[model samples]
Target: MPTPVILEDLQAAFPGWCIWRSSAGRLWATRNGRHLSQHEVDHGLCRTIDADDVAQLAEQLKEQETAEQAL
Candidate 1:
């Protein structure tokens, strides 16, 4: 699939996050408005996540979701 389509799907799947591919082709995601607390950060949450491809990005997003739910 094309990058735009992938990005659109990712955006829909993870609405709280802004997803896009950089000019250098690295996929990046950042929270739309929600900020992580210090505890969340200590538990492995990040303000932004980057990956080389969609699968990795999705995995990271899932991990973030899990971490958020755990809190």
Candidate 2:
């Protein structure tokens, strides 16, 4: 898991998502209102990413949501 600071930043950027990491240090994020994993946003794709890339991750997730909605 990342430090509390990183987790907080991710939560703020992705307001309705439960973003965290696994015991093995793999990143995981799931939507709150809907029981959906981050993978669902990207058409069942999920990847482990660096904490420092949270901002880029947030943008990707947002874009995924927009793309899904358009489908």
lDDT of 1 by residue, 1-71 (tens): 32333777888888999998899999999999988889999998889999999888988898899988888
> Which ten contiguous residues of candidate 2 have the minimum total lDDT?
44-53
Q: List the candidate 1 regions with Cα displacement exceeding 4 Å.
A: 1-5
Clashing pairs in 2: none
lDDT of each: 0.86, 0.57
- Give lDDT: candidate 2, residue 70: 64
How high is each candidate's TM-score? Answer: 0.88, 0.51
Model 1 residue 27 CA deviation (Å) reads 0.4
